[model samples]
Target: MYLLMMLSAAVVSYTATWGARYVGNRMELFSPIRSRDMHSTPVSRLGGLGIFAGFAVALLIASQSFFVKDIFRNNDAPWGILAGAAVIVAVGVADDLLDLRWWIKLIGQSAAALVVAVWGVRMTIIPFIPEPYVIDSDAVSIALTAGLIVTTMNAFNFIDGLDGLAAGVAIIGGTAFFLTAYWVHRTAILLDRSDLATLLTAVLVGACIGFLPHNWFPAKIFMGDSGAMLIGLIMASAGIVSTGQITSGLYDRANGIPTIIPILLPFAVLFLPLLDLGLAVVRRTALGRSPWSADRGHLHHKLLDIGYSHRSAVILMYLWTCVLAFGGLALAVFQWQVVMAVNLAAMTVMAGVTAWPYLRHKAPGLGPRSSAEEE
Candidate 1:
């Protein structure tokens, strides 16, 4: 069933994206190149429509499965999430077409988040407390959930500056969380508890993979704000459903990492984007500019400044995201401090290797000298 849904999603996504690309210019759905933009050419901005189409189709088919049906029957979350995703995609499409104001976009995002929060998914508990502190208050839970939705949506939006950057990271992050959700579901947790997360993550992975070929370097179709924000909301929804709402079902051993994974998994999977988001906010505010002010100071931009080509910079970020995301997964699955430490060390080594070329010039004569220098 899962396999079928995945294949269906990929095919639908590819077809939809191809169609969008075909009519993008005629429809005025091409994103204009700007000084702050990475692409030199205008490209289709409705790629999010492709992604959303794939996800929606796959989800509708998957909903026929017994487990999927059971979850939907038991709660309104499944429908609510769909509704919210639709809202986001609509907002994204509008943004692509009309270039909506930042606040207007935020309002749309807030509405969607509220839909998800009040209907089914919410961070109703904080794992850090000595005893699990359930946030039973409706207002507080909804507010917190909405904040998370906005932050996550903006995080992915901020990182979508490069071809395949956002899509690749989404694939990696979604895979990691999907694995975690699957493992817990099969081994330690109940089927219903993890089904939504696992299924949603699977859909997320398929959608990204399907769209990646078109969005790769010299991108033919940009996901634009619509696709980025939609994926962000999906990721956030999976995290909330799989972990946040299942706080009481967390592993009992407080001394180990698995016990804390319910809280850490989301952060670990999305560390890079979240970091970029944080840095952007801080840097922009410090410069006395609106936090949403556009600039070329992103981590990917820095990679370009340091001589990495667009594709290389994107692949490097993919590697970093995988390391952190899988590290979190390993911590959850094995609960071994030593294993996580080793993973962290290996990630550091990878980072060093990636940076070595940039630093090679600093060590005079250490790197191959150019012919001009030899002369």
Candidate 2:
């Protein structure tokens, strides 16, 4: 059943990418080259439509299935997520076509977040709170959920600086979310898992894979704000449904530090983007600039300045994301002894690899490879 949903989304996304190749130019939806843009040439920027098409089709179809319907009946989260996604996608499309101001974009994001909250999808429980104050007030829960959605949307938006970077991260994070959520449903009997969240995550993974062929290095089309923001909302929605709908029973099941794993897994999966977002805000504010202002000081840019080629930098980040996300999953499922042993071995290997470069001889062109050289 899950495979069917993923494949359905993949097919839709693939078709959308192909169609965009021809129609995107005609629609005047190319992302213009800017001072901070990594690409020199204008590229089709509305690729998120393909992702949305694939996801919506699979979800709408699944919502009709007898088995899925049984799991999601009367669940407003699924419908609310879709509605919020639509709002974000519209904002992204408008931004891509009209170059909307930052405040305008924020307004759109806020509206979408509020819409999801109004649909009864707010985070009612504080996942890591101590036993005494586990539950939060209605106002606090709604505000935090909405804030999380908006922050995630922007986090992903800020990291869409390199070819395949945002899409790759989305795929990795979505996979982690799916695995962790599925494990929780299968293992944690006290909790009622949202089947819709699991299904949507699977579709998100499939959409990212389907879109990557066109978005990878030397890309044909960019997902633009539409795709990035849409993915952010999807990821945030998955997290909300998975961890936020907690019951007092869940608190009873979670004992001591073990309780934190469920909360930490989502943050670990999304660590890179959130980290980048935080650093960017701090860096911008420290320089007396707007936190929303764009710059070339991202981690990717630093990697390029240090010695890595564009593709190399992207691949390195991909490896880190996989490690962090899957490592978090391992912690959720495995014992502390096993996780510690594995982490120690992995750390040793990584340390050796890092030191090897310093021990090797330097050559004239052995520094950072240029773009033309990469070609």
In candidate 2, the residue pairs with backbone N, CA or C atoms under 3 Å apart (3 or more residues apart, or in different chains) clash, namely none
Question: All models: lDDT?
Answer: 0.83, 0.79
lDDT of 2 by residue, 1-375 (tens): 776778888888988877876798777667678888888888889788889888888888778765565556877777888898889889998998889988999999999888888783777656555542354577787888899889999999988888999999988878987887776665656434546567878999998888899899998888989899999888887777666535524323333345566557778878888999999999999999988888998877776665667787788778778877887777766675777688677767754553444333264654558799999
Model 2 is weakest, by summed lDDT over 10 consecutive residues, at 248-257
For residues 1-375, write the lDDT of model 1, one tens digit per residue.
Answer: 555666788888888888888889677667567787888777888899899989998888877765556656667787788889999999998988888887898899999889888885887776665565778898998999889988999999999999999999999998898887777766655545537788888888998889999999999989988899999999998888755644555454322644467668888888888999999999999999989878999999999887888889999999988888888788765647776678879888988978876887567777877899889
Candidate 2 has a TM-score of 0.88
Best by lDDT: 1
Error of 2 at 166 (Å): 1.0
Clash pairs (backbone) in predicted model 1: none
TM-score of each: 0.94, 0.88
Cα deviation in Å at residue 335, candidate 1? 3.5
For candidate 1, give the lDDT of residue 205.
Answer: 90
